[model samples]
Target chain A: MDAESTAASKGALVDLDEATCWSLLGPAGIGRLSWTSGGKPFVVPVNYRVSDGRLEVVTAAYSAIARECDDAFVALEADSTDAEHHAGWSVLVQGTAAIDFQHPSSDGPRPWPAGVRRQLLVITPASVTGRRLT
Target chain B: MDAESTAASKGALVDLDEATCWSLLGPAGIGRLSWTSGGKPFVVPVNYRVSDGRLEVVTAAYSAIARECDDAFVALEADSTDAEHHAGWSVLVQGTAAIDFQHPSSDGPRPWPAGVRRQLLVITPASVTGRRLT
Candidate 1:
């Protein structure tokens, strides 16, 4: 079967182009950061911003994300869904995260949780993929 | 410092008890599924329902989720965030996933995308953790 047929056979979920994926991720919003700790996977919701085409999250220094994500490969996922309409799009950004003390952006993401969220987790995407459910 | 002080030092994000975590996950809705494939982490948004205290997702048989998740340890994350209020709660369910062909649920989650989503992925939680940002 051809690629089109293959996609249709599975569910006809459209594979979004790279540009569309970036467009979906351009707005600063809530996203889930997935990483491995102790050889186990963990996912947590975080407030994020797209700065210079990279994902940035402000977190507490003592939080699990700050402790485990630095210098590690992680995946950040953001999506919007309408349960009533049964339509939405999802974008996935997989990349390496590093602690950036000197993020040049003056307007970075401000985490909602109250505390000294001094540490910045910067994720430079290695791959950006997405799908649209229509 | 003491435990309470330690929590305060981090940012005062309240640690939710297991019962509360279950409560947050009780309603069926959109959640992200995270898993490791080829030593790299991947996260995708999925429609899920909690049946008998277990998380269930319906996906295409040929989808990456169906192929990579069976018998593998994974993490399912669900949350509600109010960007304006800056208040939200997130629940994380970490456990093993198995493809269940015999899911007895008569009212399982129906995939929104157009396709034959016959495979049912059931996640039995090993740990349920959550935090509330007030």
Candidate 2:
């Protein structure tokens, strides 16, 4: 809760500031995208890039994520861990997703396992919050 | 979507078999839980353990996860990656959640951030699926 790392022990979750949260979001490069469809919640890992506060990701037209997430409210999360020390940090963004066809293909890194990533999903983050396990 | 890793070039998503999916989920101990409340999606990082196909997790009673997830449909994911190789695997479990007061505390590891984790949530996975970026 406190910004001071001293107040937190290993594995203690500390609430992160907005600035720190966004800073973490940038370098993580990849994260999980969570969305709901037909009353079932689904979390899919995505190759993403954050630029100007918007999260950009590429998904196949037939992938579950693209099928369920476009034009829907979704959550994107990225995190890192120091497994040896049992510590880590996670950033979660709650936002609305839409197909950004106009987004240039060069905007971010393409999804791995290269395929027809015809749909470009952009999540305009409405709230960004994070926590660090120190 | 083929199971053959070769057919899936780097970034091409390959659908994973059920057995492989569970295997990957076990070693990847931490993942994001995606849930919906008030029609908005929330994804929170959780330290989880898998036993006999059940996903067991602990959450602070006062935290957002416990408040919105009990007795709800939720998804738990676990995965791993070789960042240098630009390849990874992700597993998703869609299931129902309930407050398992009778669940033995000995069932799984305690939540990080030593605090009041008053709720024990058990998700009886209805569907288990996965994909690998090979």
Per-model TM-score versus the true fold: 0.88, 0.87
Chain A only, candidate 2, TM-score: 0.85
Instruction: Candidate 2: give the clashing pairs.
Output: A112-B10, A112-B11, A113-B10, A113-B11, A113-B12, A114-B10, A114-B11, A114-B12
Tens digit of per-residue lDDT, candidate 1, span A19-113: 99988887688889999987689998888988888999988788899899999999999999888777789999999999887864234787777
The CA lDDT at A16 in model 1 is 97
- Residues B16-101, candidate 2: write the lDDT tens digits: 98898888887438878888888887888788878667888887667787788888999988888778888888888888887788
Clashing pairs in 1: none
Q: State the lDDT at A40 in candidate 1.
A: 80
Best by TM-score: 1
Q: Which 10-residue span in candidate 1 chain B carries the lowest summed lDDT?
A: B3-12
TM-score, cand. 1: 0.88
Candidate 2 chain A lDDT trough over 10 residues, lowest sum: A1-10
lDDT (Cα, 0-100) at A28 in candidate 1:
89
Question: In candidate 2, which residue ranges exceed 4 Å CA deviation?
Answer: A1-11, B1-11
lDDT, each prediction = 0.84, 0.79
**lDDT string, candidate 2, A1-134, tens digits:** 44344235535678999899998887538788888788777787788877677888887678777778889999988888776777789988999998877866545656776755667888999889998988
